[model samples]
Target chain A: MSEKHLQTGDALPPFGGKLRLFAMRFCPYAERSVLVLNAKNIPYDLVFINLDQKPEWIFNFSPRGAVPALEYEQGKGIFDSNVINVYLDEKYPEVPLQAADPLRRAQDKLIVENFSAAQSAYYTAAFNAQALQPSHLENYHKGLELLQKELETRGTKFLHGDQAGLVDYTLWPFLERFEALPLLGKSEYAIDKSKYDILLTYMESMKQVPAVKTYYLSADMHAKFTESRVKGDPNYNMLDSSAEVCCFRPRKKKE
Target chain B: MSEKHLQTGDALPPFGGKLRLFAMRFCPYAERSVLVLNAKNIPYDLVFINLDQKPEWIFNFSPRGAVPALEYEQGKGIFDSNVINVYLDEKYPEVPLQAADPLRRAQDKLIVENFSAAQSAYYTAAFNAQALQPSHLENYHKGLELLQKELETRGTKFLHGDQAGLVDYTLWPFLERFEALPLLGKSEYAIDKSKYDILLTYMESMKQVPAVKTYYLSADMHAKFTESRVKGDPNYNMLDSSAEVCCFRPRKKKE
Candidate 1:
């Protein structure tokens, strides 16, 4: 994968027969789909796009040109993280990511809906510090407390029993980013060990999930990206490299 | 069925084993769930709430106090129109509202997503007239054009084929309200018969569906409701009366 984002004037990459995911390297929403694909062990190609200078073809895949559009076929595609994730789960049902019970599925969606406040608070605190408020911090902690309560009630290694499910992957990207808030000088947004012992434990377990382990970034690394984004020039290509060793193939022997 | 807007002092209705849908009578989002419940022949109780002065118990059904919330169980509830609607469809698969094919299901969701701009434009035009803009109108028609083109390609009587599926029910609420725009004096949002002939035919066909037919409101009726809402005091109780006959039952003889 090239870390250089395809921008305006760039041609669409030639279609690969395997599934194609149009993503922004730093977008949490894109990361959700990537983590799901990886968890499901679906082989796919990833194409990063410059959000500020989106290529003309991005709209063809995603009407709004949003990241995480999946080109399931040669030309046709689906967008939205949840929508795409659900589609991929249903289409490739070899390893199901959703709950078997319909009601449980609805409850899972509710959990995601309920946690949105913290996600918003994190965004405001990290990217627009001036807009951050005491109420935002309150809401952030309220969301955390709710997650802790839920974790206690479920009493599982992960939210979806012994194994992480769609609900876990859906919320993991945002949780991964939340850790960066404290490093970004927003101590109020930190997940206090004493207060959120259970949620913190769940986070630790999630980090060990093989799928997340491969794509996980450190809080310090996320802080760096956040700072660059706050400066109006996102360091989207900070991870620039086309030669990273991938699981699909062994690294070529050093010549 | 009472048009009386239940306030904070209102008592929670007795629980019925059948599904209970808490909704705002005139909200398009709520209407989405109503149409779905009716379409599926699901025996559910409908309790309309005054959105401004909501019943205290609504929070038990929806944490944010937003409708339509479904009390799938006696005390437990699920919120969000899409969430509730999808739950109902999946929980009661006797009459499937979704396409059997996963890709088609993804496409159906895309159709609704692509139409959201138009839904937004209609909202502004109907309620916040001052904020209406040329771009809003452009996006509104763009959505309509996209739907029309989709209709041409799919060549189905309904977006879901012979039967009205989730996509139809999802988009119909907005289309039903779009007609009210012209009646409310926002002529720009009208679906002109000349340009939208096929789309108009589709609308007429949708009106004839037993589910939509039972809940269908005329453009004039919708206009009156929109006017009342725009005037600051939404006549939420305008439809008051549990006596009104529903598709599920015949009116009881008066003593």
Candidate 2:
């Protein structure tokens, strides 16, 4: 199925009739679109890209050469996780991932917006531990506290409702990665069972969701990937056994 | 109506039983929500916030105290321009601002995404000239060229259609601010008639949009405001003579 990331000088893969998504294996933003595609039960092909040595053709799919670019048609494409996810939900509306109420949807986006600081802190803690600050830890817990408060206010199994919807998928990737922070010796990011009982319960339910279950990587795997990335080389194909031979070769540092 | 920005020690304005939007006079993001409200012709009150001296109550409306937070109801609000704008469009569907087609909507967002480099260049040129580089100028023109090509492909008076829509309004604020760059002696940021014939024509058409025209500040006025901002004291009240007296008093730096 040619699931590999075609690097520089690699020929553009032949396009099948199905929708194709350009993604990076370990990117939370790319996971966003992937989760939306899975939740909608849409038939699509995923092409994992090596962000460090991106294929020349990626520019055709995404102007900025970023991930989560959806090729809706043969020659045309759209990028940005929010833009692509919204388009997928609207285009394939059989299984609606968004709320019927506009206010709920707006609130969902607000939750994502508010959580960005925590996301940044996670990135710093995971990949640049030397730069980590007290504020990063504070912001991370603040984000978790806000999420817990929101869960109590809504009295729902997930942020979207009883079922995991767009909001859950949008944030779950970060939560998935957040688990790895503690494993990487950053215990401050650990989600304490006592303090975050509600959030933990919600996370368990989200993990059980069929769509999330399929693409979900464990904390150990995320920690390994984070370590590789922190060492100045990212093992983007760690999960793909087919690409294990390439992983045996010495990694090249990006110029 | 006290449309003025309340600062520290000032009382939170009493609810007036109407939709209120917290904004700044020259902020591009704030202009986004304002333009959306104006386009929808939704009855809303505009309260220009002193971003430098944000009122203690602004935090209630916007968590980060950023401008363009929509106070939909008394004491309840939503932040982020995209979130607030989408809410306004859906909440008041009498005048639809987004494209009916999902693909078109996605394309519109991409256009904004692609044009962001130029917006940043505009910011650097206007406020921090020392940081300006050749690549910034190159990106600025690349953005203009891209817009011109899109206009040619769309073959419409506006990006949305005959009338300006959310896409048009979303990009207009930056274009409106870009004009000030030329007046600030940054000729490299100028959209010359010879170079941007199609884009210039489109810009002219947008200026005629009743929604845009109402809140539109002339380039000269924008230049004056930009100079003040670059000098570390933004003349947010320059256009409003009624609020000019407050501007004369020694402005206090935010704690």
- Among these predicted structures, which one has the highest TM-score? 2
* TM-score attained by model 2: 0.96
lDDT of 1 by residue, A1-255 (tens): 777788889999999799999998779999999999999999999999989888999998998899999999999889999899999999999989899989989998989999999899989999999998898998899888988898899888888889998999999998999999999988878899989999999999999999899889988888988987787766666777553543235433312
Model 2 agreement with the true structure over A34-139: per-residue lDDT tens digits = 8999988999988888888888889988987999899999978899999999999998999999999999999999988888899999999998889989999999
lDDT of each: 0.88, 0.89
Instruction: Please give the clash total of every predicted structure, in order.
Output: 2, 0
List the DockQ of the predictions in order.
0.72, 0.92
Model 1 ranges off by over 4 Å: A242-255, B241-255
Report the Cα lDDT for residue B78, model 2.
95
Candidate 2 has a DockQ of 0.92
Error of 2 at A92 (Å): 0.8
